[model samples]
Target: MKIRAAVLEKIGAAAPYAQSLPLRVQEVELDPPGPGEVLVRIRAAGLCHSDLSVINGSRPRPTPMVLGHESAGEVVEVANDVRDLRPGDRVVLVFVPSCGGCVPCAEGRPALCEPGAVSNTAGTLLSGERRLHIGETRLNHHTGVSCFAEYAVVSRRSCVKLEADISFAEAALFGCAVLTGVGAVINTARVQAGSTVAVLGLGGVGLNALLAAVASGAREIVAIDLNEDKLALARELGATMTVNASDEGAATAIRTATHGGVDYAFEMAGSIKAMELAYLITRRGGTTITAGLPSPEHKFSFSPVSLVGEERTLRGSYIGSSVPVRDIARYVDLYQRGKLPVNRLMGEQIGLADINAGFDRLATGHSLRDVVVF
Candidate 1:
């Protein structure tokens, strides 16, 4: 069947927003679901930082690609071989999990499942091909679902069923930013009550981290951001203190406020300096979690002595150690309890045509998240 989607023809090209260069909306073709797969009619999708990074050439990806990864929808059809998932079921898309019996999944690390290892890079299932097209060229596939389109064919392992009454846009966030941030705090760090915490960057992922720290009973949640608007959003998301990193030395400011350092620091923005600050702000023996995705070309510099003497440990996290089966449900319950503030995270909403505009919002780093509805 044919599908409508936003296609990024190449890197460094402007999305539908400024010029007709790398990104634009075009009608494309889609394949039917394969075995162990389900066809999802996307209700809503999010314009996340990673999507923008790929477009800006920070995160290089195949061109003529369908741009969305964070999305939620109802299952319109499920393959004959697929079980446990049926038509009419509401679900959130996850590109990182393929099999529950894999080595990673068996160790309670579904996010590291091997079979779907490079789904975002390889852009397809085991067949190793995409189902989208622009004119004659095969559009490069991204994260199997490529949910920028109205309909997507995805493996059953890539989706987590959601409860009714939850907005698909909000559910879509659980796929990426929300999962990464909240999972970093709750799943990876396992922050204890009254733990002093600091978060670097107040974008979608960082805001979710801020909220999760609050839910974890953190005593003080210090948020840092170069943009004041994002800092304001961070405060709304449950930050107890805010730091403007534009002109001020953020690390020094955090140190001043916390009277030395915090027990835990999380880096959500993909900045090398910010990652260093996350390390610097941790007290002796304090843990620092790096949740940002730096470009392949970027690298950080740190001294060997700092790691050994400060007794501080720096760790990296991808997708926040999220376990879809258990954590997605737990977060949904938190949302329903009015604790997660899922509604407040909605910065803007646009149709598939306005998809490029949503990308602009993400580039400016102002909103918690922008939704692209099909």
Candidate 2:
């Protein structure tokens, strides 16, 4: 079938993406779902930083790929031998497609599924096949979910069913922002109630982390970002404090405000500078978790003595270190109970044709979670 999709032919294009137009919306061919896969009609998808990373050549991946990962859609078709899911079910697409038998899956860490990582790096589905084509040219999948298209064929493991009442836009946020941010707090950091916490960066993911930290009963939630508008929004979303990271003395200011340092500091900004600041603001023996995906070429350095002497912990979180099957439902339940309040993280809605402009807004920090509503 032919469907309209956003295709990124090259990377490292100049900014003002509306002018550069890194992603071209074009009609492309899609295959029916193969075994262990399903065909989904995308209803809504978010323009996330991970997608931007690919377009800017920061996080390198094979080119000529359909570049969406965070999306919600309805199942239109299912392949033979697939069970437990059928047509008409609402589903959110997860970037990682876990093979049940992989070591990480067996160890209850589907987010680290070895085969999923391999497939993502190779730009192939879990089965090592390409299902999208442009005339005679085969296109690569984006993290097993090339969902910028109107329709996508993805592995069954890439989707999780949603409740009937949840809007596609709301479900779409869960696929990435919510899962990664909230999971970073609850799963990766396991932040204790009444703990002092700090979240660096106020993008979609950072805002979600702020929301989750609040829900976790964090006593002092400090929100840091270079954007003042985002800082204001964070305050509205229940952040107890806000800081502008652009200040040269920002780390010193944060330490002073927290009365020494925070118990936990989370780095959501994919910048080495932000990671170093997060580390600096964490109290001795405190844990600092980073969910940022900086380029492989970039590396952050810190004093080795701090790790051994202070016994401080630094960790990286991918996909929030989530076990999607177990965590998505739990997080959704929190949303329904009025605890998570993820709805506040949503910004504006756009159509598919406005995608390049949407990306421009994201790059300029002019928007939060911009959903492409079908």
Candidate 3:
């Protein structure tokens, strides 16, 4: 079948993506689901920074790739050996395609699945095969889910069936932002009720972290970001305080506001500076969790003595350390109960043609969660 998909032919073609237009919307042929894979009709896809990183050459991936990962769709067809899901089932695409037999999967850490990582790096499905072609040219998948297209063939492990009432846009958000942000708090950090929390970089993920902190009953929630608009939105969305990270006195202000420092500081802005600031604001024995993905070449340093003496813990949270099957359902239930208002994160509704412009806003930090509703 021929489907309209966003194909990135080159990386870093130039910025203000609207001007450079790196991702060309073109018609491509897609294959039917193979064994252990399912064909999905993508209903909605989110514009995540991870995709932008690839376009701008900040995060390197194989070129000529179909780039999209966070999405929600309906299963249109199921291949042989796939039994748990069927046609018409609502599903959210997971970036990591977990092989159930992997060591991490066996240990209930599907987010760290070994085969999934290898397959993602290879730009192939879990079966190590490509299912997309542009006439004679083969196209690589993005994180096992090239969901920017109208249809996607993905591994069974790449999807989580959703409840009937959840909207595609909301489900798509669950695929990345919610999972990474909320998961970082509840799973990685295990933030306690009445704990002090500070989240740096108020983008979609950071805001979701703030929401999770609020739901967890945190006494103090400080939102840090360079954007005043985002900081204002953070305050509206339950942040107890806000700080402009651009301010030189920002660190001191945060320390004073929290009476020294917060119990947990989450860095969601993919930057070494943000990580350093997050580390600085964490109280003694507190945890600093970073869910951001900076360029592989980027690195940050820490004081070894402070880490030892203060007992400060630093950890990286990928996909929020989530087991999607379990965590998505739990988070959705909370969303239904009016606890997690992830809907507030939605910024714009756009068609696939406006994708490049949407990306420009995303790259410029002008929009939160822009959705391509097919």
Candidate 4:
């Protein structure tokens, strides 16, 4: 079938993406769902930093790929082997498609499924196939979910059926931002009530972390960001205090305010500098968790003595160390109950034609969670 999708022809394009136009919205052919796969009509897709990383060449992937992972859609068709889901079911697309037989999947850590990682890195579906093409040219899939189009064909393992009543725009966030952010606090850190917490980088993911911290009953929640507008929003979203990352005394101020730093610090900005601050602001015996995906070439150095003496725990969380099938449903229940006010993160709703301009806004670090509404 013919579909309109955003294709990243190349990477490392100059910014002012509105002008450089890295992603070209063009017509492409999509194949039918294979066994264990489903065809979905994409209702909404969010522009996230993970996508931005590819555009900026910080997180390199195969190019000429359809560039979307965070999305929600209605099932239109299901392959024969996929008996659990049917047409008309609303679902959020997960970037990693776990094969149940993999070691990580068996250990309740589907996010690290060996086969999923291989397929994602190779730009293929769990079945190791490409279902998109332009005449004789085959395009790579973005983490097995090329969802920046009217339709997508994804492995059944890449979807979490949504039982909650919510708009597609709201459900789209659960796939990435909400899962990564909320899961970081609830799943990764296991933040206890009355514990102090700090979150670095108030983007969609970071702000969601703030919301989760509040829901978890954290005594003091500190929000840090370079953008003043974002800091203001953080304050509105239940943060006890907000700090500008650029301030010279930002670390000192946070340490002083929280009485020698917070019990848990999260780095969601996908920058080495943010990671540094997240570590610096963590108190003795505290934990620092980073879900940020900086360039693979980038490295962060720290003193082992601090880890030994302070008994500090530094961990890296991918997909918030989440089990998507279980966590997505739980998080959605929280959202519907008015505990996780994720709706406040919604920014501009745009059409596919304006995608380049939308990304330009994303690159500015000023936009909220912008979604492409079909």
Best by lDDT: 4
The per-residue C-alpha lDDT of model 4 at residue 145 equals 92
Tally clashes: model 4.
0
Q: In candidate 2, what are the lDDT values of residues 312-346, reduced to their tens digit?
A: 99999999999887888999989999998888888
lDDT of 4 by residue, 6-85 (tens): 99999999988888999999999999999999999999999999999998999999978999999999999999999999
Instruction: After superposing candidate 4 on the true structure, give the runs of residues whose Cα lies further than 4 Å from its correct spot.
Output: none
Candidate 2's C-alpha runs over 4 A off are none
CA-lDDT, candidates in order: 0.82, 0.92, 0.93, 0.94
- Local accuracy of candidate 3 as per-residue lDDT tens digits, 1-374: 99999999988888777888899999999998899999999999999999999998888999799999999999999997999999999999999999999889999999999999999999999999899999899999999999999999999999999984988988899999999999999999999999999999888899999999999999999999889999999999999999988899888889888988999999999989999999989988888999999999998999899999999899999999999999999999999999999999997989998899999999887698999999
Report how far residue 84 has shifted in candidate 3, in Å: 1.1
What TM-score would each prediction reach against the true structure? 0.95, 0.99, 0.99, 0.99
lDDT of 1 by residue, 30-70 (tens): 87787888889999988888888888889887777888888
> Global CA lDDT of candidate 4, please?
0.94
| Residue-pair clashes, model 1 | 1
The lDDT ranking, best first, is 4, 3, 2, 1
Question: Is 1 or 2 the stronger prediction by lDDT?
Answer: 2
Model 2 CA lDDT for position 223: 97
